[model samples]
Target chain A: MDFAPTPEQQALREKVVRFARDHLGARAAEHDRDATFDESGWKACADFGVLGWPIKKEYGGGGLDPLTAIMAYEALGEGCVDNGLVFAINNHLFACAVYIADHGTEEQRRRWLPALCDGSLVGAHALSEPETGSDMLSLTTTAVRDGDGYVLNGTKKFISNGPRADLFVVFARTGGDDVAPQRALSAFVVPADTPGLTARDIPKAGLRGTLMGEITFDGCVLGEDQRLGAEGAGYQLFTSTMEWERGFMFASQVGVMSRLTDRCAAYAARRRQFGRPIGSFQSVSHRIADMRVRLELARLMLYKVGWLRSRGRLAMQEASMLKLYVSEGLKTTALDAMQIHGARGYTEELGIEREVRDVLAGTIYGGTSDIQRSIIAGLMGLPTAA
Target chain B: MTDDIAKTVRSFIGEHVQDGEPGDDHDIFATGSVSSLFAVQLVMWVERTFGIAVHPTDLDIENFRTVNHVVRFVESRRAAAAPA
Candidate 1:
C-alpha cells in the first residue's frame, strides 16, 4: 500500500497550516483563563471552510474526502495552538452535523446543513446524561409521541458546545423491551431555542475555550421531520457516528503531540545545565525520544483509520484502538514535555501546563479510555458485558 | 441457503453463549444467550458470510433475536439486493 500523501493533500495541509497560524487561536491563554468560547476563532474556522471540510459542497461545505479531512485537522492542530477550539469544531462536525448529513432526510439536510456549514447555526451532540456516561443504551431520556411531533424530557451533561450551540442532535428512548435495550432509542435534531430547552455552561479544569455544559430539555417539542433515520435507530446512529468521533476527531491531537515534541526538543537543546545542553543527558533525550515514538504511532493509527473510512469500510476495531492509543499517548507526551521543560512548563504563560490539562480530558471524553478498551476487546471476539 | 445461514449463526452463538440449550426461536437477548457485543459480532458475521451490508435501520433485534430469524433476515436482504 502507498503511504505517501498526494500533492493535493499536501497542498491542503500547507494551506490549513498557513491559515490557522495567521487566523486561529489568537489570545488562547486569555480564553482559557476565563473559560470562554472564542467566537471569533470559530467564525474564522467557518470562513476558512474547516466547519464543512468533510460535508458535501452542495450544502455549503468543502466536501473533502476522509483522508484529506484528517490531514487538514492534523495541520489545524499543528498550526493553531487552541486545542479547545479545535475540539469544539470536531464535536460540532462529527457528533452533531454528521447526524443530519449521514442520516437526515433530503428535507432535513436541506433545512439544517447549509446553516450548520456556515456560522448561522452552531451544533452540539446531546448524549452522556449525568447518570449514563458510557452506558449509552440505558439513557433515561424520554421522547413521547405528541399530536404530530414528540416531546423530549431529559438532562444531557458535559455536552461540548452546549452553551453556544443553536442545534443539538439529541438521543432519546422511543420504544423497545428492556431485554432488547439497543432497539429502544431514537435520534432527533432539535433546535436549541425549543421552548423548554436550557443550556448552562459548566466551567471545567481544561478544554475551557470550548464551552461545556449541562442542557435540560423540559418537555421540548420537536416535529416529526426532526427524527433522524427511522424510529428505534438512535443506538445504531450513534454507533455509526462513533467511528468518526473516536478516530478522525483525534487527528488534531496527533498534531498537538508533534508540536509538543518539537517544542520540548527545542527547549532541551536550548536550555543548558552544567555548561552543556540538556540534550546531552540521556534522561532528557529519552523522554524526547518517547514523545517522538508516541507521535509516530498515533499518526500511523490515525491515518490508517482515515484510509479505512475513505474506502467506506467498517473500522470499529481500528477506531477504538486509535482512540485509546492517541488520547492516552497525548497525555503521556504532554506530561513528558512538562517534566522536560521543568518550571517553565508548569507556568501558565509557557502553555505547556495548559497542554497537559487539555490532553488529560481526551482519555475521558468521546467515550472514556475504559469504554474504548471494552470496545476493542469485544470486537476481538472476546465476550464483554460492556 | 437458509440452512447454511442458520448453521453459521448457530456456530457463532455456541462459541459465545454458555449454560443454555437455546431453541431456534429463543429470545437471544432475554435469555442471556448473547450480550450486545455478540449482537454486533453476529451482524458482522452475517454481512461478511453472505456479502450483504445491513443498514443501520435494519439493526433491530427482531431481525437478530434467533438463528431462525437471522436466516430469514439474510434471505430477505439477498432478495432485495437481487434484480427483478
Candidate 2:
C-alpha cells in the first residue's frame, strides 16, 4: 500500500541516474544510428554491478531485495536514454541469469554463475522460432536424446542478446502428445561455441540496441547434463518463467512513462504558440496529464506483483496485467512525447522516433498485449474476445 | 546461520529459472536463464529474504555482482536493521 522508497533505495536511485546520464545519454543516438552494442558501456555496467543486482552472493550477485531492485530499475529507465541498452541488460539478467540461478545443479552453478555475474559471459534466451511467435506449445524445435547428449535442430527468431551471447537457454520439444502438447518440451543451457549453433542479426522496428537475431541449432549436440530441469519439464519451466518476465521485464517501462510525462510537461511549459505555452491548451495539457495517470497506475501494479511474488504468492495474472499495462502505457507515452515534440520527435535525429519504435515492441514481445489480456481474462473467469 | 534466507533466494530462483546448475554465474541472464521481468521480483526477494532495505544505490549489477554478494548484503542489512 505504501509506495515511498526507503533511504537505501533512494541512494541507489541517485547513483544509477547519474550513471545513466554519464554513460547511456547522448551516445544513445549514436548507438541507434550505428546499431552499436556498446561493449564498453556494457562492461562498465558490470563494474558498477549492474549485471548481478538480484543474484545471490554465492553466485556473484548484489543481493538487493525485489521491490528495491524494481525501484532501482525504474530509476535506471527514467534516466537512461538508451532504452535499447537498458533493454538488453534486462534481457540478460532476467532471461538468462535467473534461469541458471534457479535450476542449475550445484556443479553447474559453480561453473557458470560466477562468469555471468562478473560479466565474463553474455547470455541469451533462444525460444521463439521462425514458425512460432506466441504458440510455444506448438513450437517445432526438436531436442532428441542421444547417448550422453541431445541433438538439437531448429531455428529461433527474434532472440534478444543473440549476436554476442556466449551461453544460451534453449527450449526444444523432447516428447509430448498432441492432447497435452507441452509434455515433450525441455530446456537446455548451451554454450555459443558448440559447432552446430549459429546466430545472425535480425533488424527490428525498434529497441535497436538489443542485438536480436535468428539462431539456428543445426543438429547441435549438448551433454545430458546440459538439459535444464528434468526432461519434458520445458513446458512447465516456460510457463513459470513467463510470470517472472511479465512482472520484472516491464518494470523499466514504468520509468519510461514517467520520463515521457516529465518531458512532455516541461516541453508544454516552454514551447509556445498563440502567445502562450502550448500546455495552456487543454489538448496538450490533458495528454500530459493522462500520461502521468498511466505511469502511476502502472507503477502500482508492478509493485503489487513484486510484493505478492516475494510473499510466495502465484502472481501470474498480476504479472500479466502489469506487463500489459506498462507496455501499452509506454507506447502511449512515447507517442504523446513525440506528438508534443512535433518535428523533433519525428526526426531520427532527436531519438524520440527511436523511443516510439522501441516501445512498440513492448506490445508484441514478452507476450503480446493481446495475450496478456487473454491470460488475465481467463484467470478472472471473464469472457474474452473471440 | 539459517540457510533460511539463502534457501529463500534459491527457491525464488528455482521457481522461475529453467533447470540448470544452481550456481552457474554465466548461466543466469545470458542463457535465457531468467525472464527480463525478474528485476522487481529479485528486489522484493532481497527485501524479504535478508530482512533489510535495498538502497537504490546498491541496486545495479554491483550489489548483484554475485550470489554471494546478495547473501552477504542481506545478512549485513538485516543485522544493521536489527535493534541492538
Candidate 3:
C-alpha cells in the first residue's frame, strides 16, 4: 500500500532527471529536422550511466531494481525533450539488453552484458518483417541448423536502432510446419557484423533521431551458443518478455504525458486571450485537466506493473492495459497541447508539432492499441480473434 | 491430492477449450483447443492455485502441454517445496 518512493529511489529519480535535462536533447531540433541519431547525446547518457540503470552491477550496470528503474526512466522522459533519443535508449535497454539478462545462459550474460552496459555496443530487437507485423507466429524468417551452427535468412523492417546497433536479439523459425505453432521459432543474439547481415535506413515522420531501418540477414551464420533460450522456445520467450517491452518501455510515455500537461498548464496560465489568461476559459482549462487526469492514471498503472515485476510476478494483463492506456493517453495529451497552444503548437517553432508526430507512433509500435485491446480481451477469458 | 489438482486443472482448461472436453493427455496446443496465450495464463494459474513458483527454466512447453503434465508439474513442485 505504500505509494511513495523510498528516499534512495527519490534521490535516483532526481539525479536522472537532472542528468537528462543537462546532458541530453541539446540537438533535438537539429536531429529531428535532419532525421539523424544524436551520437553526442548517446555518449553523454553512456557516460552518465543512463544506459545501464536496470542491469545487474556485476555486468557493469547500475543494477537499480525494476520499480526504481521505471521511476528513473519516467524522470528521463519528463526531463529529456528529445523523444526519439529516449525511444532509442528504451529499445536498446528494454528490448535487447534485458532479453539477454533475463533469458541468456550465464556464459551468454558474461559475454554480452558488460559491453552493452558500457555502451561499447548498441542493441535492437528484430521481430517485425516485411510480411509480419502483429502475426509473429507467421513470421517467415528461417534459421536452418548447420554443422554446429545455424544459417539465418530473413528481413526485419521497422527496427529501432537497427542502423547503428552492434547486436540484435532476433526471432526466427527453427522448427518446421509440423511443429506446434507455439514452439516453431527460436531466439538468437546476432551480432551486426555477421557476414550476411546488412541494414538500410528507413526514415519516418517523428522519433526520426532513432533511425528506424530494415535489416536483411542473408545466410548469416550463427554459432549454437548464440541461441538465447532453448530451441523451439521463441514464442514462449517472447510472451514472457513482452511485459518488459510493453510496460517499462512506455514509462517514458507516461513521463511525456506529464511533460506535455505541465507545459500546457504553464502556457494557459500566461498566454492571454479576450483580455484574460487562456486558463480562465473553461474549454482550455478542461483540456489541461483531462491531460492531468490521464497522467496520474497512467503513472499508477505503470507503477503497478513495475511493482509486480520487481516481485517476480506475472504482469501480462496489467502490462497490456498500461501499454494501451499510456500510448493512447500521451497521443491525446500531445494533441490537446497542440490545440491549447493554437498557432504555436501547430508550427515548428514551439516543437509541439514534433511532440504530436513522436507520440503518433506510440500506439503503433510495441503492439498497436488495437492489438493491446485484443490481448486484454483474451486475458479476460473472452474469445478473441488473436 | 492428485485427483483434486487434476480436477481443478481440467476445469480451468475446459473453460478455454472450444470443442468437447479433452482427455488427460490431449495436446491442447497441437489440437488448437486454446490459443498460445493460454499457455501463459495456465502457468500463472498454476502458480496462483498451487502456491508454487514457475521459474524461467520451467518454461518448457512439456511442463504444461496437457492436464497430465500440469498435474505432474504441480506435484513435483509441491514435493520439492515440502519440509524434509
Candidate 4:
C-alpha cells in the first residue's frame, strides 16, 4: 500500500521545517546551555501555529487533523534542534490545552483557550507530586469545598512549564469523605497568581531549558466556575488528556529521530578516520542503519496512532504501543547518534548529548517504559509476568 | 445481558483465545489468549452490545485478565446501567 504523505501534508511539513530551522535550530545549543525555556523562541512557535495545530480554529488554533498535526510536529523536530522547547510546547498543547478542548464548558473554553492558543498564557499539568507520579489515584492533593469555592492544598514535583505557566490544570480530591477516590477526584483551572500558589524551579541534568519545577498549592482558592468538568469527573478528564499526551507527544521525537540519523550520516560521511570517512566502517554504518530502521518503524506506528486518533477511534492500545516503541526508539537512536559522532556527539557545544538526555526522559515521563509495557500487556489480556 | 448473551460472549473469547483450554477461568489478556488489540475491540463490543460505558477506572488487569472476568464485568455494568 502507498504510504506517501499527501501534497498538502508535504507543504505543511516543509513550512514547519523552515520555521523551526530559522527560529530554533541555530539557537538550540545556546538554549540548551541556558537551562531556561526559550520564551522568545516559544512565542515564535506560537506565531507559526505549532502551539495550536491540534486544537480547533474557533479557539485560535490551526485546527489541523491529528495525522497532519503530528506530521507537522515531526517535521518541526527534524528542523528544530532544541528538544526542551519542543517538550515544553508539547506539554502545553497535549496535556493542558487538550483538557479544555475535550471537557471544558463553553465559557471556560472561551476564556482560557484563546490566550493559550496564541501563547499569551503558558500552561502546565501539575499531577506528579513528590509522593505520587504514576499513582495519581493515591495523590494527597485536596480541593475541599467551602461555599462556592474550593480551597486547594498539595505539592507537585518535576512539573514542566511550572515556572512560566500562567494557567494550571490541577487535580485534587473532592469526593465525599467516605467515597473512594475513583469518584472523588476533580480538576480545575487555577491562575498562577492565586494567592497561595507558588512554584520553584527544579534543577535537572537535561531538558533544563524548559523550566521544570515543584508547584505548591497551599489552600489556594478557586471558584466553582473554574472546574473543568463535573466535580467527580476529574480523574476521567486527566485520563483522557493523558491518553492524548502519550499518543501525540511522541510525534516530535519521530522528527527528532530523523534529525539524529541525518546528523550522524553527515558526520560519518565527512569526518575522516584512517584516511576514510568513519561511516565506511562496518560498525558505524550498522549503527546508522539501525537508527534508520527505528526511525521508519516508529514512524509507522505513530502514523497509525495519529490516524486512529483522527478517526475518533478508541486508540488506547495503539497509543500504548506507539508510546512504548517510540520512546525507546528515541533513546536508542540518540545513543547511537552519540556513538557515531564520537566526542562531537558527547560535547555540549554541538547539543547532541542534550538531545540524548532529553530522549532519556521519553520513557520516564508520560508514564514510564515499564508502565507502557504494563498497559500493553494489560491490553493484551496478558498476565503481569508477560 | 441475559444468561444466553453472557454465554455467547464467553464462548466468543473461549473459542478465539489462543489459550484453547476452553474453560470458564481462561485468562485472556495475560495469557496471549488474545491479542491486545482484541481487548480494545472486545471493550467496544461489550459497550455496544450492552449499552454500558466502561469507566476507565474499570480498565485493569484485575477485571480484564480472564475471559470469565471480562464477561462478569460486562454483566455487572449491564446490571448497573439497567433502568429502574
Please list the Cα RMSD from the true structure of every candidate, rounded to 1 decimal place.
2.7, 10.9, 1.7, 6.5
Query: What is the overall TM-score of model 2 with all chains considered together?
Result: 0.80
TM-score of model number 1: 0.93
Interface RMSD of 1: 3.1
Instruction: Show model 3 residue runs off by greater than 4 Å.
Output: B31-33, B47-58, B76-84
The candidate with the higher DockQ, 1 or 2, is 1
lDDT of 1 by residue, A4-91 (tens): 8999999999999899889988889988999888899998998888999999998888899888999999999999898989989999
Runs with alpha carbons beyond 4 Å of true place in candidate 2: A176-179, A382-386, B1-84
Q: How high is the lDDT of residue A57 in model 3?
A: 94
Highest-DockQ candidate: 3
Supply candidate 1's per-residue lDDT for A366. Answer: 88
What DockQ, on C-alphas, does every prediction get? 0.38, 0.03, 0.45, 0.10
Q: After superposition, how far is residue B65 of candidate 3 from its true place, in Å?
A: 1.5
lDDT of 2 by residue, A73-192 (tens): 888888888888888888888888888777778877788888888888988888898888877867889988888899999999999989878999999998745323434688999999
Q: How would you encode candidate 3's per-residue C-alpha lDDT over A1-386 as one tens digit per residue?
A: 99999999899888988988888888898999999888898888888888898999998899888899999999999999999999999999999999999999999999999988888899999999999999898999999999998999999999999999999999999998788788889999999999999999998999998989999999999999999999998998898888899999999888889889999999999999899999999999999999999999999999999998888777888999999999998988999999999998999989999999999999999999999998888776777664
lDDT of 4: 0.81
- Would you list the clashing residue pairs of candidate 3? none
Comparing 2 and 3 on TM-score, the stronger one: 3
True contacts kept of 3: 0.20
In model 4, pairs of residues that clash are A36-A209, A37-A209, A380-B29, A380-B36, A381-B29, A381-B30, A382-B29, A382-B30, A383-B30
| Clashing residue pairs for model 1 | none
Model 3: lDDT of residue A179: 85
* lDDT of the candidates, in the order given: 0.87, 0.78, 0.91, 0.81
| Candidate 2: C-alpha lDDT | 0.78
